[model samples]
Target: MEAALSLPATLVAKLIEDAERHGMSVDEYCRAILSESRAGDRSSAQAAVINEPSLDDLKLEQLSVERLSLTAVGRTFESGALSGHINRLLPLKIGCRVLWSLLSDEGVGPTIREFREEMWSRVGSLRDYLRMIDEDYARPRGDRLHASFPNSSDAAIKRFLNQYIIRKSGLNAEQSSGAMIDFGLIGISDTGRVQFTEVGRNFSLLSNPVLDEEDHRGPSLSADEQVLILSQIRTEMMREWKFMRHVLDGIHVGSNTPTSLLARINRRYGPGTKADWSASVMPHMRSGVLGRMQALGLVKRTFIENRVEYRVTPLALVILEADVV
Candidate 1:
């Protein structure tokens, strides 16, 4: 009966996110929440959804069809599938830079407390923003961890912390951004400071470059930095990510285009496997799977007549030949 209801997409996304957070399948999560709601207090049960919109609300501009661009967020219903909240948004070089910032100070870069307060603090005050701004402005312009906030107001800075940071890096709620941690690069120390693991230390050496506003390229990866960046695609992307090998296989088998590769993955996924999120996988593959591979020289990407295609690199072919799978 519940399956018949399309339900609010937002709620559906939240359900999957909560399920992933608890290391449960969507069905398992729903059952657990329902059992809890039935057995204990109804208010706190994770299953209890409130304030559904009415038909009139559906007609509102916010929920209108014209704003349907956000329907592609990855929804992981299966446990431990290719569904982690890695930085699907940022390119690998910027990610390296982010890691470098955390590895800057000796034994203490950005503390988890500071990250949590910046990313998700309800007690955020103007004084806090001003203090942070003063601290940041104290440093050289491009040398600040966060892009300097001298010109932006408190509210603007807060919004940037939530929206821009969330979109660019991802809400850490853990290590400033769960992206680095998921990629097996960074972790939190006993002192609650954001620190690099053995892998991240290697990544930091090259990522720390002189990036300044004089170079509007703050958001873009510069050529010199790209040359400086280490090749973690074969190591981390393929080693850590379960989805990369399959994407490599797809490219090798002539499923080179994004659309074709996506179709192949959805078609090949099985019931017992951990990858049942095919319904919401495109967003993850763009940069997360394909882009990283291309950036790290594992694949070649080209656009022809509005269609982008990828071809496996010689290095990637070597990995494919060596792979037993």
Candidate 2:
């Protein structure tokens, strides 16, 4: 039998708009809205159903549902019915006490000790419980693993869930409609509260860009190409002049070349050599250093014998020559 509800026209229009934005059908949108509204009630029912089960059994069920849903989602972990259903249920079922505490006035953001106590109070060892979940979810079904860990930790999972709620509910003015940036599910605010942002919520429909395998080598960028590519880098650094000074100061004091600069960064930050350093530590440095140097007419790169090499321009020497003590 088909179910029907008496919804206001305005609400129906908004739901239709949201469904279109997410590439879901109007029926799917209605289902999602209904599901979200009933999440707490449904969770209560689920809790009642498993109240008598041992903690091990409950944990096993949690792990099983997570694995099955991950499999159903095709290992890519798209935000849909299965993922949403799991998100709504898991925390309430597995970490009900902790969730209750968080809801309570006495619960300041849970510390590691508090978290451990809450987690282990229900189950045996927290690590073993987590390992069980991980082992089952990560086991290979066909070509890919059951569940993917795009971000680390349970806190991250919660953050993702919270973000999903905000996005689905349209809590913010900016999220009226259309695509937005993917800031991951978790965010650490300036005040150090681990919370979800509208940015994270909007990312539910977006694709995860990071590749899984380590050995999958991709294309390389050329010097001119890299320069053009780094326009965003230039704008970012210009926004913070102190960052530019900090980077230039490092290069000026050291005798190492650009290639060796990456090694120096890797010693402090670990792995991926130049690519890692460029993306991580020196994102501002790439175009910041080069653009500033070019503006001051200090450095120039030329292709010689099919190899790109950089040298200090005469104008750059004039400035640095005066600064040299």
Candidate 3:
């Protein structure tokens, strides 16, 4: 037997939104909420307020759907197969940039522009992006590392960090959107100074857990920095394919080729009956997801007798194993 509890319309809506973001059905979300409520002290009436929507909920309500897309995909990956590594990948490149800038400074964090400029210097040039791809992809399966980026300008980077990364990382908007504070990496003081967190330092310091030495793009980068960069690149790839998980899943190790993968993905997500997905979606996925996965040591891409073939790496098998478990 069950009883229906009355809930505010706004609260119900917020639950639905949260459910969607976490890739959970409404029933699952409600069950989790009820379980949490039961675990708390029932004597206190405050537990009931857990269902109440906050200002952030209101802001999300007003914002467009694209802004909130990251929230769902990031969490869904985290909750399932990528459980151990998902936290390291949120906000992808931008998150790593923020953490690294904070780590290098060791005191005051870099301003939004400073961080963006540094990242731009690394991968801004078309030559640089291509070189990174070559270094990352033209290697033994176990030696590849995550190395890719969306073409972006300083203003675009700044906007993405402030408007998207911050919110997606679970930081408040109104109080934390100032220059000094960002997603949990940096904090602001009363005098307007900024300092990074221990969490940020640790994140920036993660050693390369999967890739090999040949995969490291820069000799100057510390092991932790290399790992963080790879994490960011991997995260960026996942975020780009957020809407196309089906295509990713469809791409089996021995069964798909570059041409076939492109065809399969285009059939599903492309502008059907008119524009070629090969002209648009295929190029983006080739450069973004498949290229990055090959670089990350997650997947191996090889040219066999003039045809390209893909195989899952050992590290990727770990993720697949988790999915089954």
**C-alpha RMSD of each candidate structure in angstroms:** 22.9, 24.4, 24.3
Which ten residues in a row are the worst by lDDT in model 2?
A: 67-76
Highest lDDT model number: 1
Q: Tens digit of lDDT per residue, candidate 1, span 1-325?
A: 4666677999999999999999999999999988987777765454443432111211122122222211111111122322332322232333334433333323444655454344333223322332454364464332232332223456754544443232224444342434444444556555555555555544443322222322322322334433333234334444343466777888898998877887776765633345445465555644455644554456777778978788998867887898665
- Scored against the true structure, residue 206 in model 2 reaches a CA lDDT of 21
Could you give candidate 2's per-residue lDDT for residues 234-280 as a string of tens digits?
33223223333333444555523556554443453334532234345
Top of the candidates by TM-score: 1
> What ranking of all candidate models by lDDT puts the best one first?
1, 3, 2
How displaced is residue 142 in candidate 1, in Å? 25
What lDDT score is found at residue 183 in candidate 2? 17
Q: Give lDDT per model, in order.
A: 0.47, 0.35, 0.43
TM-score of each: 0.47, 0.20, 0.41
| Candidate 2 TM-score to native | 0.20
Candidate 1 weakest ten by summed lDDT: 68-77
Order the numbered candidates by TM-score, best leading: 1, 3, 2
- Cand. 1 Cα-lDDT: 0.47
